[model samples]
Target: MAKFQSLKEAVAENLRDGDTVAFEGFTHLIPHAAAHEAIRQGIKDLTLIRMTPDIIYDQMIGMGLAKKVVFSYAGNPGVGLLRRMRDAIENGWPRAIETEEHSHAAMANAYEAGAAGLPCAIFRGYRGAGLREVNPNIRSVTCPFTGEELAAVPAHRPDVAFIHAQKANRRGDVLIEGIVGVQKEAVLASKRSVVTVEEIVDDFDDLHPNLCILPHWTVTSIVEVPGGAHPSYTHGYYDRDNAAYLEWDRVSADRDLFTAWMKENVLDAGPEIFAARVKEL
Candidate 1:
């Protein structure tokens, strides 16, 4: 069994330059805060893989912490284009591998294929769509059984999968409420997996059995840190700071402002210090 003394140690020890890392979360829930800390600590040349990346990916790419990014969508909720990510792609800042998905189901379908140890997965529902034209990486394959061409997305198996859960035990048994679709696939497809939880339980039995998403045996490391998902929120703990996200979206448009923000919030602050700052916010 792998043991981690703390969240910081786990992030520092496991994350390295040039590794392909996946973050498990939706629009704004249970982000890989510890992994972001690793990025802030000068872990460079990382290839970030995700279904839909938001501010986290934008921040990393803007700060030059990532070398490449593989994802479907990236932007703020209502603020048009993601400033940093758009600028990066427009100016050819970092190596970008873009993919497109018309809906949540399509993205989930791709991850399902990845988890199932298949080279690709096909869906005939979204045929001759704009998403297919935009993403050249996704190929169209003819179905062997039906002889129909459908969109086939290649498998994505990352080097590491990082996730933040609502609760877990010392042994890394995770419990997350609601959807567990892509998270489950990402964890299964990765070579190494790390989980950070808002609260730690003494035993797996402490959590309702149905709510448990990941077992201890599947997780390589477990870290306990309350309020770990700052910009992102744990389900029942707190709500997302919409004002802060808006502020981030506005300021991050300028490169200088983005750099300054990262230095102040991420680079200069450790886990404890960062949590303290969030409390002030």
Candidate 2:
């Protein structure tokens, strides 16, 4: 069952060095505060997993928190490149991290397969793709019904997964309303999970049946962290911080500039800063 805890306590207890972790959101509800907390606690050598890795993963890579990254697409959303991730790969700034790339379809299937406790995910893909040549994890499988060939990748069962949501009830059920991704599968596939929410209420009322709501049993911890998804907007709380994204393009371009920004904005900042930053928005 889920335990209500501080982000610090939750991260410290659940995440560890060399563990495989996934911080997931589609375009919204990105778990920035939890990632920042992981960085602040100096968790290292993680095998980070995400379908679309944006700025939070970039920051994690810049901070040398990852030894490898498994993802489909990685960038700064509308912005160009994840400069820090590129530096790690090209220049070995922190360290040259290993990458296992896959297509968006394959990643989504893999998460579902993991949630089902399958050994591997078999999907029809990589027909004309070059990714199979580079990513050794992608292999070919033969179908029984026909002689058709299919793509196969190992299931993505992370050690821990993190997600941000609109709210949770007193029972610790997380409610995600907008732009749902593979977060539900990612959490179900992981050994442990953490959720940061805008608030916790007595009950989850008038919830849509189709929306994602993770039961308390599936989540390891729930942290009440309003504005935790900042830079990436929550559904109804605030708009996406396009200015912050633009500023990151500048701050992350140079090594020294990025380091300074992290020191002031992330490393030195506390959890309250997240709510404060959101309030300012």
Candidate 3:
């Protein structure tokens, strides 16, 4: 069951060095605060997983926290390249990080397969793609019935999954509104899950039955963190911080600037600052 805890406590208990963790949210509700907390705690050698790895992964990778990154797309979102990630791959700055790339379809299916307790996810992808040449995980399986070859990738069963949501009730059921991604499957597929929410309400009254709600049984811990997804918008809570995304392109470009930025903004700051940032938005 989900126990209410601070972001610091949740990260300390559920995440650790050399663990495979998925911090998922898609375009919105990205768990920036939780990732920041992990950075502040100086967790290292993490195998980070995400469908779309943006600035947060860039920060983690830049800080030499990630030993490997498993993902579909890697970038700064609306901005240009993830300079830090590129630097790590190209120059081995901070550290050399291994990368496993996949397509959007493959990643989504892999997460789903993991949630279903499957060993691998088979989908019709990478037909003419170059990922198969480099990624050993990309292989083909012949269908037993039809003899059709399908792409197969190992399921993403992470040590823990982290996500940000709009709200959670007293029961600890998390509500994720707007642009849902593989967060649900990521949570269900993980050994443990941490959720940060904008607020904790008594109940979700008149909510649609089909809405995305991770039952308390599926969640291990919940942190009440308003603006936990800052820089990434939370539905009905705040807008995406476009300026931050723009500024990251500058901060992450130079090694000295990146280190200084992390020292001042992340190393020196705490999770409490995120709530204050949301007030300004």
Model 1 clash pairs? none
**lDDT tens string, model 3, 146-248?**
9999999999999999999999999999898789988999999999999999999999887988789999999999999888899998989999999999999
Name the regions of candidate 1 deviating beyond 4 angstroms.
93-106, 277-281
Q: Judged by lDDT, which candidate is best? A: 3
Worst 10 residues of 3 by lDDT: 272-281
On residues 1-281, what C-alpha lDDT tens digit does candidate 1 reach at each position? 54655867777777888898888687545564675677667788888877777888787777777777777667676555778888777875544533334445556776677778887767765565677677665677877888988777777678888887787776666778855637878877777888877778777765566784777777788887777777766677766666767887778888888878878777777667535534644
TM per model?
A: 0.88, 0.98, 0.98
What is the C-alpha lDDT profile of model 2 across 23-42, one tens digit per residue? 99987999999999999999
Per-residue error for 24 in candidate 3, Å, reads 0.5
In candidate 3 the C-alpha lDDT for residue 72 amounts to 91
lDDT score, candidate 2: 0.93
What would the TM-score be for candidate 1 when compared with the true structure?
Answer: 0.88
